[model samples]
Target: MQSLIQQYFPNVLLLKQEFINSTIETLYMVFWTAIIAGILGTLLGVILVATGPEGILKNSVLYNILEKIINICRSIPFIIMLALIQPITRFLTGTTIGTTAALVPLVIGVIPFFARQIENALLEVDPGVIEAAESMGTSPLGIIFRVYLVEGLPSIIRVSSVTIINLIGLTAMAGAIGAGGLGNLAITRGYNRFQTDVTIVATLIILVLVFASQFISNTLIKKTSH
Candidate 1:
């Protein structure tokens, strides 16, 4: 059994330990980055919606400033943002070359992107629902929480799925800077070493992770939605 396995899956067997470690590292980066980006982006998104011209808060100055900031950050490519923020990353993580360092860029890169997504999701909430809440004398905070967030839950889940998948791709780019993960494993051990099998296996694992995320997200959306 061992001999047969080894014959067909030599590369997988050879890099089994690396494959496990890198997969775990990628999960670690994705989980934490998602949490941080999720919270900040949600806040920024809500603010963007609340401060729009027709928003409950209706502060154009604040809205424009935040919108510009989000736009500028989102405009920069992830790879360049990773390099451009090296100094900040080093200061925060004490090293700009590992999985921890990678989180800095990963979170920064996704925050604006997720914020825009969340804003769009919230915007999709029905205006009549918001008006009903307002007529009931609901405060702005109440309307935002009970109306926008609740009504948009399904859309938010869908957008979150998309954001997470994008973050996974960004993590691959992070591997270029020694952020050891499937991406690093695929590139450094597989491609650079000419180990085609290793690359294929790594790519397959990433695909599995992505599909799993999408499935879970879709399930949650279905459960939450009417």
Candidate 2:
């Protein structure tokens, strides 16, 4: 088995190299999308919380528009979004079949999802704390920036970690569309060729990625929550 891969697939090592490269690509997509989505979603969520009926900056106009946008975006499946945003991805990344191209859809896919999570996390913040901020003459902006954002940091990080891991999984699925990564390798090279070894390696790599992320995130959350 080893001799066959070494001789026939000189790139067997390259496959491992590809695994690492793809892992890095996946991380790049996940982190960049998460950061952008985290900020935008946090803002959207804060707006959702602060502008709901009894919210500090309640505005039926703004609230309705935000709610509808989030709902509509969330309704679209990630696979559909990949195809749906092909032109945009090409425009942004100059190609629609590699790691860079993968990011555009990944970001669009995650923002609404994370925004919803951020909304839920922020909503969990104590209303009394928000009220206190208001009572102290803190502007709505100040309340969101300081009170809500700060207090919600731990939960946001924890949720962001989950969002990122989910994005990694999504990246694998993107392989079906030619976004070369572990999934691409698994499907195109592994399954098609009957090389269960490739599939096993890819799955193990993904599991390790998830576990490592969980470990690091759990530690951070514990430290921050303290």
Candidate 3:
């Protein structure tokens, strides 16, 4: 067993601790980014939904403004966004490197993505359900929380799963700026070092993470569906 590992997966054995640490860093970045962005994105999405021309709180100006902001952010490619936002990242994290600093770009990059997903998800809620709630004299806030959100839960989970998968991929790119994750290992230690084993191992682990996240999300969606 040991011989086979050393032969087929030498780098895995050689950099055992690195693989573990990088995986942890990757998870750390993903978890925190998702939480922070999830809240902000969901809020923006809800507001966009509530204030749209057809929304309960109907405000074309607010909706168009918010929509334009989200679209602008989404238009910028992630890599440039990383370099472009270096000043802000440094100001916020006091450095433009490492897992913590990486969160700045990661969150900013993902908010628009997640917000759009959330908006689409919430939009899937039937207009009649909203009307029924309004007829009952429910406040817009109450209708949003109880009717739109509840009905949209399954779709929200589905979109959230896709967003998280995208976030995982983004974390790898974050490594280009020294964010310290499997991507860092893959690039610096694997590709740069000319060690195919490290690169392969890093990719395999990232795939596992993506698949696991999708599985968990599917499960939640199933349970949440009415």
Candidate 4:
């Protein structure tokens, strides 16, 4: 296998192992980060909507605090957040480098991003449906689950697709800190070494992944939506 690659694609063959490892690392980082972020973000977003001025459980104090916290966190740049949260990341993952360490910042950085997306998606649900549910004596929790989440499913899918694509880009930046992935491979072995072919290949792979994600998400949205 190695011999054949080397014979046919000598330039990339030398970094074939690194390519595979980096791809796996990126997938690992993105997958775990997305899971954690998706859960937290969904919860937080639902809370934001449910506690807003017109929400089922509106509370000025709680809504203000949560909104401010999300806004503050989202305001920080991802790269800066990566550097700013080094100590916390180290505490969580026991190191400030590698895929594991990168997960901390990735999850933290993406939570607010996806939270806002989820919030918007939920907001897009027709207010009349929610009112009708309430008029029928549906519990707050039931309305949230059946009305907001269910009605917002397609929009949520769309936003989730956007978030995942953004996450792919963030994973690339994570490579700057030695979080081994295609981004790191491109920078360290491709850019640093002036290997144009390597850089192009890494970029193309990322693009393919992004496109595939979009396609799947769009398909799901079309199937679920009216």
- Tally clashing residue pairs in candidate 4: 0
Model 4 alpha-carbon drift over 4 Å, by segment: 1-9
Error of 1 at 54 (Å): 2.2
Arranged by TM-score with the best first, the candidates are 3, 1, 4, 2
Clashing pairs in 1: none
What's model 2's lDDT at 153?
A: 82
Error of 1 at 183 (Å): 0.5
Encode model 1's per-residue lDDT on 52-130: one tens digit a residue.
8768889989999999999999999988898899999999989998898899999999999999999999999988988
TM-score, one value per model: 0.96, 0.89, 0.98, 0.95
Q: Candidate 2, residue 3: CA error in Å? A: 9.7
Instruction: Give lDDT: candidate 4, residue 17.
Output: 85
Per-residue lDDT of model 3, residues 22-113, tens digit only: 99999999999999999999999999999987799999999999999999999999999999999999999899999999999999999999
Cα lDDT tens digits, model 2, 1-226, are 8888776545456677777877777677667777777778777787888888877788999989988998999999899999999999989889998877887888888888888888787877888998888889998888888988889888888888888788889989997678877888888878888877777778788888889889999998998884
lDDT at 209, model 3: 100
Off by over 4 Å in 2: 1-14
How much lDDT does each candidate structure score?
A: 0.92, 0.82, 0.95, 0.93
- In model 3, the runs with Cα more than 4 Å from the true position are none
On TM-score, the candidate that comes out on top is 3
Question: What 10-residue stretch in candidate 1 is worst by lDDT?
Answer: 5-14
